[model samples]
Target: MRDLVAPALASLVCLAILIGLGVWQLERKAWKEALIDRIVARSRIDPPAPLPAFDAFDPARDEFERVRVHGRFLNDKETLVHGLAPGDTPGRALQGYYVITPLRLDDGRIVLVNRGFVPTELKEVARRAAGQVEGEATVTGMLRQSEVRAMFVPAPNPQTGEWFNRDVPGIAAAKGLATAGPSGVAPYLIEADQTPNPGGWPKGGQLRVDLPNNHLQYAFTWFGLALCLVGVFTAFALRRLRGETGNGETGENPASATATPPRP
Candidate 1:
């Protein structure tokens, strides 16, 4: 009887801990759902006013916030990022690159803008020669923080104009933009608002807003597993109690059936 006390208590404590974990996952699911809702609401609201000159970009603050910016295209410093796809039909599954060009903001800050996607063949000397943006231009695009690819990938060497990832600071320096100020270029990429462009490569304005909410399914799976474990333990405990009573009734023990000493 004493030995059973130790083992039974230990088993029950372990089950309680597992049930607690399942509850925690449900709480986490609710938190994630609320965050997604906030993002969706913000996306539909009107874009904020253009940021003033010398405003430092906060990667955490302005990540998904939309804002309009007017700038001139510095196409001469453009770099093509390899291994990007377009979402349009004419721009099918063919191999293409993101045309990353620097937009000199009205306040003198240089921002790397993903102008659009272009097929690799379009970058040939002859085709690219005819695709230049002539003179001063007004580019209406979102103010996006730089996108830094954290995983293992080839780095961008802007001198060769051969890039596999979007490294904004490196690209900014390669493009010969001054970065010694407080508002130095951010280390991210911006998807320009769907604006008209010449020489069609990067099909812009295809930014799809999607956030998956499968926490309900995940919560159900965890709770169901916990319930199954609880049912198993309850049956085992009841059967053990019944076995002790049956043994005493058959004269297998000196103790009476109703007052039998608990089995170990």
Candidate 2:
């Protein structure tokens, strides 16, 4: 019994850990589901609030927020990135590049506005220069976070007017603006709502808010595995215990029979 103590204790500890992991997965599932629900609710709200001032805007709370803004396109500072979708990503198709321009706000700050997708044929630097829409425009769109992925190249040459991805800091520096300081450019990007522009480039209004939360399934899998392991170990332990009992009974029976002697 004493020898079995250590092994049994170890087995119990392992079982507890497996159970704890299963519980943690369940909690994670719940959290993910709630997050999805919140996003869906925000996306479908009847009317969104007006765009906040640059001085008061906060990306973490305001990203994807639909609002109205008054600004003029700083077309000269536009940067074109390769492998972008021009609006409507119905099927995973790579059709064009994202022609992103900065909107000069009332304050000295700037907002990088993703004017929308333009086909590869229209991505030429000359074509872009010809497509500038100057003057003040009232645009209604969702505030967005910048999409910064791993760089295909070490550093982008903004001067070349070619970009691998939309890098706010690099693009800002290239635009002859100080890349630092509290009153500098906004951190995130903007996706304008389907507001039309003079140029034939795709209009904004391409908002897709899809979230996936399958924590329940994950929790079930983890718990199921833990139960299976416990069941297998229990069966093996019972089989060993039964075998020992049977051997002991047989040994006692023979001794008792001999003690009864040949007296039939």
Please name the candidate that would achieve the greatest TM-score relative to the true structure. Answer: 2
How would you encode candidate 1's per-residue C-alpha lDDT over 163-195 as one tens digit per residue?
Answer: 886667777887787673546654555666677
Any residue pairs clashing in model 1, and if so which? 116-202, 117-201, 117-202, 118-201, 118-202, 146-187, 146-188, 146-189, 147-188, 147-189
* Cα shift from native, residue 164, model 1 (Å): 2.9
Model 2, which residues run further than 4 Å from truth?
Answer: 1-4, 44-47, 53-57, 84-91, 125-131, 151-155, 178-183, 244-264
Q: Itemize residue pairs with steric clashes in candidate 2.
A: 29-215, 86-117, 193-205, 194-204, 194-205
RMSD of each: 6.6, 4.9
- Candidate 2 local lDDT, 126-241, one digit each (tens): 76554577788766677776567673654566667777777776777888865544467877667777676666565455556766667677778777877887887676567555
Q: Candidate 2: deviation at residue 212, Å?
A: 2.5
